[model samples]
Target: MNPARFLLPLSLLAAVACSSDASKKDPVAEARFENEKRIGDENITEKQERDATFVVDVASDGQLEVELGRLAQQQSTTPAVKDFGQRMATQHAEISQALGVLAEQKGIVLPAGLGAEQQKTRQELAALTGAAFDKKYLELMVDDHANDVDAFDDMSEDAYDGDIRGFAAKYLPRLKEHLELAKQVQDQVEAAK
Candidate 1:
């Protein structure tokens, strides 16, 4: 056997092994590897990003219901719920308008009604009265606001479009304030009953 042929084969194997190890060391590749582990076959893609935005829009609409329900349920009875509902109605309406404009501009259409979770909440709130209504309403407000804030924060951080990021940035503060108000109202409701 020729020494040159033997040397070439060994060098080729070494090069292949080294390249494989180098590919493993790359951070972008590593991060992608991690993502693959977490998301499995449901990979994040541009189409998925667009579809995911509808979920966000639906959430915005749901927040409107949560706020409006609080207003409608309590305005006749509870002053604080009325006040907070007014704020919710105003802020959520504005967010809805902004999202509408963005949706038009982006050519995305949101689903017509609140998803099942929001509808269930709406029905649950509708069925209660007085103190029970106030407690359940305040609990929903707090939970909804927390979720709103987090969703917006994540969108701001990782959204695929300028419109989505802008929407998230514009709404996050309002969501935080809503959460705080919800907490205060919960405390007041607790003390009152």
Candidate 2:
């Protein structure tokens, strides 16, 4: 006989029922579920779908571009500087090719050209020649390799993919060697003037 009490209980009951039924599949959720199922059935893993190329790729591309740019600048440099440039070009090309193979294996696409960091370094290298060119290039090489060694070390320790980790570990020594060579080159350039 008390109308308000009866209406309040009924409203509470309706609210509870609505909340309980909220898990019933909505159109959006159903579509999402269907899409996920399709993707799973097609055997697409996260590694395959993701572009996980990291710092090594960036370093490789940048060094390659910068070395090529130096060779192209037609600076009146000595044979030793030219030889260093040639070595950088060769080493970076091999590294880039290695990255390309990994990218292909992982079904991830990468840029055909250099990464932005590499492009920037190359532009900087392009502005100088002779002693200036040598100093800048050596400094860039040392700084870049330092950054790369840290990145590769971090990735080697933390990468989820076995192949990526292996690649990082394998490349670490070579990168360290490059850093040493760069330091020597820097000292030689600095001592020359």
Candidate 3:
């Protein structure tokens, strides 16, 4: 019933409301709010989002490698290149299956097929044949495997989820081996040219 007591409580409520409004105006806070809203899960942390993104990206890359490997197998003239392509197709297929299981367990939805850039790369390779196809395919394999190795290595060390980190660590050795083999095959292809 005291006027001063009521005014004090009203002032505190107004300050709290103003602080909430200020947070809504903050760019970082607003971005976080938007992300949470988009995802429809306020409990999903940044680290969780990053882990899910990694899964999706790796899945997409695996799909691309499989497609490219099949193309190489069919188009390459060199025997060694063909063998390399076979190895890529076989090994990446196995990797993709394992990644698919992981993704399913994590509730992350992977892309159904190649992304736009991957589709472009596939189209470019699809347009070539014989030695030209072999050259371009080997070059792409080398570049892709190099990047895959680095990304897997980083994820193996830095992933927020223990399962994701373990998955990366498990595949990193194979990825390194693939990169080395790709380089060797690429050298053979270039040397013959």
**For every candidate, C-alpha RMSD to the true structure in Å:** 7.5, 8.0, 7.4
Estimate candidate 3's alpha-carbon lDDT, on a 0 to 1 scale: 0.89
CA deviation > 4 Å runs, candidate 3: 1-44
Error of 3 at 19 (Å): 22
Model 1 stretches astray by more than 4 angstroms: 1-51, 54-67, 70-76
Error at 158, model 1, angstroms:
1.1
Against the hidden true structure, what lDDT does model 1 obtain? 0.72
What's each prediction's TM-score? 0.68, 0.66, 0.77
Better of 2 and 3 by TM-score: 3
Against the unseen true structure, what C-alpha lDDT does each candidate score?
0.72, 0.69, 0.89
Per-residue alpha-carbon lDDT of candidate 2 for residues 91-155, written as tens digits (9 for 90 to 100): 76777677678767866566666667767766777777787777776776788789778877877
TM-score of model 2 vs. true structure: 0.66
- Tens digit per residue, CA lDDT, model 3, 1-193: 7899999989999999999987758788889989879776634577788888889888888888889889988898899988888888889889999999998998889899899999999999999999989888988888888899988999999888999999999999999999999999988888888
Model 1 weakest 10-residue run by lDDT? 67-76
lDDT tens digits by residue: candidate 1, 96-182: 777777777777766665677667767777777777777877887788778778878887767767667777887788778878988
Best by lDDT: 3
